[model samples]
Target: MARFDQAEGLRRMLAGPKPRVFTFLSALKEDEKSGMLVNLGVTLARQGNQVTMVDARASEDSIGAWLNASNDQTLLDVAQQQRTMKEAIKIVAAGLSVTMLTRNADCMAKLPPEGARQLSRVFDVVAHRSDLVIVDSEINLEAGFPLASLDDSELVIQVSADPDMIKAAYGLIKRVSNRLGRRGYGILVSGASEKEARLIYTNMAQAAGRYLAVPLHYVGNVPDDEHLRKAAHLGRSVIDAFPKARASLAFSRLAEQLAMSARTTLGIEGVPELGVGLGI
Candidate 1:
């Protein structure tokens, strides 16, 4: 709770004391989001922002399994009005030391209405904590449950990969644009080589700018490197494990862009009013 309540912790970096939220949403592809978040988490951590990476696709790091959350009530146990997001996040897991929420969205046909409500509130609390929250969700989006609640976030990142993946991602973007309105922003290129990714992104961005009138930027990418998979398997950040690698550096750059974008979007600078500045 120290970081959440500690305004000075952030003031040192910005002219204001408000927290910024950047949400990453991906189609239900396995590879796209997990890697994207791995890098995003490292970057946010490096930038002095306490980043909470949620496998919103719900991969098994749910609060129920954590001793930290078990000491209190789990997020699914809280009512929306009764929920205090700060306490929910305080329930830590092992390193990442992160609070991860993972679940298979494709099998929700059997879930009761109450079950759905609990899940919705869980994400709401997560959205409230930390400086930035990145969600890695399954591709199949239900109309009301997850997507509706995510509107609480400022920006949404829909990530995809390869030649076919590029087209698929754009299709998803064009569809989400109307429902999400103008705040619909940021296109992430994942698991693509520098040349292929650039060429594909150029075509997509040109199409979007000319038609949808949206400016898309690829903030993070994983160059099909094997080290990333190893780090994720070992539950360590690539930024720490492979600090000198190109992939890690690229991820860091992505985090920097995201941090700068959040600040610019929030209209903050010149040291936060909390009478402090960030050491970074």
Candidate 2:
């Protein structure tokens, strides 16, 4: 038998610098949200996008589920290591192409004296190393937590689409905008839907723009893809199984849209830039 040539494979997979932050609500129980995120991440990765999901919530039903995490380590570990955060995450993920931040609560209980400064530096480094730093913050982590660290992102996309959900998203968006210190722009839509995805979900988009006052780029509504079920059952990304599927296509389109948005609107050319300072 021959060696798997793991290093060679990684060199091929992570080739450029593209990082984006996308944190979701902790309100979603792990069983529901984590699978959706895994579905989203694997789909994006297959499109040749580098994505590192930080499980900020570390709840029983989040990225915490993957490592059997009892606490969250991404922000803390990244901040503590400073320059090493990017290298550490890439190395860890390179070791397992589809991995997430472990859930370690104690690690996040309180920040060190210069924790915020360390995190900002880490974000700068990771932004250059990966195609996208898809962070997952607790849905309602209040304002002023590390969620604001996404200040550097081109845009902070809020992910709820239902009207009732949009109502809650308003409060959430208000806090985030206050944290980021502006009107706040983001994608406001759901993850999964039925056949005729557009028809089923387009109304949600219309309502979001009307109510939330934010442009809601509709990431494709995932069908009840069997591969998603299988992967969740086995605790693996569907890309590791059915690399070519509707779910995969949706994420690819989403990644493309993000790249486009970054170039035109994120204030900087073809990458994200911090929009507002914490005025509130």
Best lDDT goes to which candidate?
1
Mind giving the per-residue lDDT tens digits that candidate 1 earns over 87-168? 4454232222244342245434555655655666576556555566655543344333243355445444444455566666
lDDT of 2 by residue, 156-241 (tens): 43334345655555556566655554343443244445334343235544654576554443333444467777766886776676
- Cα TM-score of candidate 1: 0.66
lDDT of 2: 0.49
Best by TM-score: 1
Clashes of 2: 16
Off by over 4 Å in 2: 1-19, 67-75, 81-109, 139-141, 154-166, 178-181, 191-215, 259-280
Residue runs of model 1 more than 4 Å from their true location after superposition: 1-19, 60-74, 80-87, 90-128, 138-149, 152-161, 211-213, 266-280
**Residue 8 in model 1: shift from native, Å?**
31
Alpha carbon lDDT at 57, candidate 2? 59
Worst 10 residues of 2 by lDDT: 271-280
